[model samples]
Target: MKTPKNQFWNAKYSTLVFSLAGFGFACNLAKMLLLPENTNALVFSLEALAMLFFLALLFVAINCQKQHEKWIKEGKEKSAKNIKTLMDENEDLKKRIAEYELKENEEKRFASYQEKMLRKIFSDGKSATDKEHFLHLLAESFAAGAAVLYKESEPSGQFIVEEVYALPEDFIPQPFVLGEGFHGQAAQDLSPIVVSSIDADMIPVASGLGNTSTGWLYCLPVVKEGRCVYLIEMVTFKEVEIDKMWNEISTRLVDMKIF
Candidate 1:
């Protein structure tokens, strides 16, 4: 048990055993030579006793060395296991940090894109024609390819599609009544509507020379002068974000002075 504790103690114990064995062997040799005139049996017995003590000390020295080596090997094994555990935990922490940074960067990028569109809408001429061009610009930026601009018709108070971009060859011009359809419902509620799956028959998009489904539709009502006066409908080939996209667009159009 003492040998299994500290290496310093084990080394000291072995050294002490070797020193005692040397001193005992020297004393027995001196007694046998200097006292040669004594009894032969007594001298022989003293020599035998010294030899046994030296042998026992040698055994203790070797045992201590073996126990120390075993303890050292066990310590190394334990240290290796602990080091491996720390390395695994460090790698997991690094992965989590990287994932968080990626998500934050994505949110910032989307916000920047939305802000750029807001500035583009306000940098054009104040005339009604300029507003239609702004709508066309929005369609191009969002990859929608189809955009319709509606103004509240005077006296009739109907939300009609006054201007359009990328209309199909077979498309017909229609005005939306209150709560009539998706666009109408958004106008009635003064809210935004998003349709992820598009049916070309029901919701048509004019791309190039033909009518088709773009798989995504968004309609927003622009409120001005305390009434829902305008509506913008967009059809896109790809899925669009709901909150991030529509929220910014509606917020910008709410204060826009171009009626």
Candidate 2:
């Protein structure tokens, strides 16, 4: 396809060639009328000039046509490149969307698993409950091995350790008085406590005799009817998605016991 610019130049060159030819013809006729005795020079000179003009114009027209073809070819190539770039970008966007949806689905599935575990723990109200079995279920859910449950008592305000799932053999189960350590503080304030990393020499993993957890510890207080009723603790080796664990799992600890 020829561009508008190429077509305009073609027309302009053709017009100039025709105008030159007409002017030469008019000059030849004038010369013939003025000197009929020596008309040979006028005829020969005008014919030669007109022939040269036509040859030059023909060469220019051919060159212009070639240039026009080149312009059309270049335009097509540029369009093809742009189309390829756009297709690549679209594929990248689609891959990103697919990854996001997959992540969302996995999160929902894990949250569902956490909820089901809670429901199972409280399945039979009065049935004989096994604290160890319940803790094992919790550990499996979190991909961790250790678990603990605490019960907060009245007036004296002590948090007694009710269950220990996978503590080390040397570790002892004990109680925590209010304001003693982070665990005690969590009980007193009725809030959740998360230690991303534990330093054994500095903080006590167990309250009574003081044991180092040696890993991450999560302490959550379960409040009921304006009083803190329970404190659930767990120390795990792997890093967890803290916000998701807190939001989806910890909140369900209310009214739940190790039994």
Candidate 3:
């Protein structure tokens, strides 16, 4: 259970001590051989035995040092693996939390939008067929820079702009058949359409100061009695999650139909 650092120091200390002891024994044996008068048979035999003992101790210390080094290597590799595993788990947890928070925020936005629409439709007793009022309200609720509501002509089967909110005075609405363009496609399919990366000249909002270009355009269809009667187009500088609220609005509008 020794730490790598402690094991390293212990191995080094043992090697040093055993090496010094072995070297000292060898020196003594050499000295005894030089002084032949003092080198008796019995004394030489004892000195040789002592030298062998030190050599054995040195060998054991060297082997123990190698074992300690192996243990340290294994410990470092295991520690590194554990650290990597923890880091991967932490990254995964962060991703999950971010996804959950994004979903929660979208739900909150949808709830607030629905609540405001309900108040305008029922609490204020505003007629659902009032295209101008609803167009402005929808644009304000979704924070759009500009909005336009298109109504389908009953006889001609073409969609034409009926109401506009925050558009330039010089701006004109283009009329199109059900399958002609993005606005028409949403009405034809009875579904929402999203257009992105629009240029500044495409949908421009004029103010007293200047004109600002919108980047995103959303086309939402209004269904009544199994048919699309209106297509609302709104533009904003940035994208918003307005698509999810379509289902709720469609349901309420269908329920409140005059036919």
Candidate 4:
């Protein structure tokens, strides 16, 4: 596109060309009326000057027309380029949105699978073996490296990790108190919690003892009779959209009577 500055320059050129043409015509008319016919030299000189002025005016008009055409062509090219760029950007955004939708569908499928497994666990009279199977299924479905079940220790007023899966053979699960650690806090609040970074604030620095290799944490409370009975802990290497996923999972858990 021709910018505002270029348009202003073009207008100025047009005005100057017209003004010169008018001045040349006026001078020619005056010379024909006032100058004496006997003065041949002056008349010829004046006529030559008028001819030169007219020629210059014609040349300038042609040049200005060419410049205007060039600017118009450039403006069209720029508009085409801008349209192509916007179309490319729109396509890229559509592709990204499709990929995200596919990922979201996969997550929902995983959540559904977890719900089925939990239903089976609870349907089997809440057996110890069933709970173990449920924990294992959750670990696999959520792609977590480890999953643990924790129960509150009333005597010590702490929450103890009762069952853990995919843990190192020698690693021991520790006890933590309410508001003391991430897991405990989740259990205390009866709300799901996610820690994206271990080094971040609000997460206990010393709480990640055995799982130093993992960077993210997910904690969910297993509520029973409107109270937190157990806590599900998951450790992952990458962060998950915990709030969004948990909201969906919580709804499924309630529907499946696992909450």
Candidate 5:
């Protein structure tokens, strides 16, 4: 766990030790040279001992230098690995942040689209056909293929289709009474329902009229003055949480004076 800086310092210490040992050996040889001819056998023995000691010190110093070099190389390797790990982590963080930002932008754009649709629907003197166009635009924005607007007829007590868009040209609008079908139940309760599987509780209707009934369906009630004034139906190939999206749409509708 020693850092590169510490390794450098250690290497310097080893070099210093080696250099000092060599200097001491040179000083000892100079002292031996300054001795007179009368220097005794003991002096010669002492000289030999000094030479042996210097050699031993030199060996130790060389070993220390090699060990220091090894440690320095290992430190460099570890430092490189640490730097690489940090770089990789930083890149991953950047990618995740970018993804989150993109998702946030998409949500904002979808909200703006919903607001525009609501404004078009509730504009003064807007016709049923105009509202149908707005609904279709809304569905298209959400990537849905078909959309329908249904309202309850008070005289007949039946849910009559008020506007339909993205349907086949030959398809005809149909009516259903409360408690009779899924759409009727959704309207009567003023609640939203999402059907992931069509075979669960749905009654099969005519299919050749561009009503595939092969994918997910969403029914959302549009309540006005404590009564359901309209029902929004959407069909899609993938399961979608239309209720959650509807909550955001409703908030935008209120803000835009569409409800």
Candidate 6:
């Protein structure tokens, strides 16, 4: 019970053996017909053996040629697969590099905007007492719907709204203590507070057109001599670069004696 592979090899070997034996027999018959009087068996055997050796060498050469061709074809296919893998890797690397460059450019533009904002707001030669002008500047800079400037009242020791910008005339600002609401909390912590995606139920911001729920709110406290001197609240209908604005303000606020 030979397997298919064993059967194939057996068939091939049988064919080669039969072909060699048939050639030897044919040669002997031809020699007998050509030289009837000189019947030398040794000469016939030598000629037959030489012919079989030549045929075996030819078969060996042909088999080696086929094996060489098979090796070449396999090597070419493997090389092609390797080349395709390398090309795919190169494309992936290109995408990653492109993403990194885009992110770097965005960061650069954000930094530039922050730098300009710092120069415009802190170096305007306007005193902190000019609360209205300051609020107007901030509202315009951030595209804010409304803005409120609160200053620490020397008499009451409470944060009181000093100025308002772009808000309705009827809207009144309520004063608060150090730990009261968002503005007071920012002042208490000496940090900035950001609120995003406000609900309609919360306090609505009133503009010249009408009252609407603000999308974003920012509360920033200006500190001087280890105490919060002012708190600024900005409301916008769209998101702004609040972190960049805060960074610029905090870095430069310490230098200005705005108290």
In candidate 5 the C-alpha lDDT for residue 226 amounts to 65
For model 6, how big is the CA root-mean-square deviation?
9.5
| Decreasing lDDT order of the candidates | 6, 3, 1, 4, 5, 2
lDDT of 2 by residue, 1-259 (tens): 5556866786697679767866866785665567666558867677668667866876786678678768877987999899899999999999999999999999798777656655654464532356556556666666665777777766567878787776778887678777777677777876767777766566566543246566677776666666566666777676654434553344444434332
Candidate 1 residue-wise lDDT, 230-259, digit = tens: 888877878756435664566566655555
Per-model C-alpha lDDT, please? 0.71, 0.67, 0.73, 0.71, 0.70, 0.74
Candidate 1, run of 10 with poorest lDDT: 205-214
Candidate 5 residues 83-121, lDDT tens each? Answer: 999999999999999999999998898677656655654
> Every model's Cα RMSD, please?
8.5, 8.4, 5.9, 8.4, 7.9, 9.5
Model 4 — which ten-residue stretch has the worst lDDT? Answer: 200-209
TM-score of every candidate = 0.52, 0.53, 0.64, 0.52, 0.51, 0.58
* Highest lDDT against the true fold, candidate: 6
Candidate 4: stretches off by over 4 Å:
1-46, 126-148, 153-157, 160-174, 193-218, 224-227, 233-259
Q: Per model, state how many residue pairs clash.
A: 0, 1, 0, 0, 0, 0
Which is the leading candidate under TM-score? 3
**Per-residue lDDT for 1-259 in model 3, tens only?**
5566766687678778877876887788787778678557888788778778877877887788788779878989999999999999999999999999999997887788767766654443444667577667768766788888778796656877788899889877676678777777788888888777667657653321134455677888888766778878888777766766676777776677621
Specify the poorest-scoring 10-residue window by lDDT in model 3. Answer: 205-214
Better of 2 and 6 by lDDT: 6
Error of 6 at 228 (Å): 5.4
lDDT of 6 by residue, 57-135 (tens): 7678668757865886698789889999999999999999999999999999988888887677766767455657767
What TM-score would you give candidate 2 relative to the actual structure? 0.53
With a 3 Å backbone cut-off (N, CA, C), the pairs that clash in candidate 3 are: none
lDDT of 4 at 15: 82
Global Cα lDDT for candidate 4:
0.71
Any residue pairs clashing in model 6, and if so which?
A: none
- C-alpha RMSD in Å of predicted model 3 compared with the true structure: 5.9
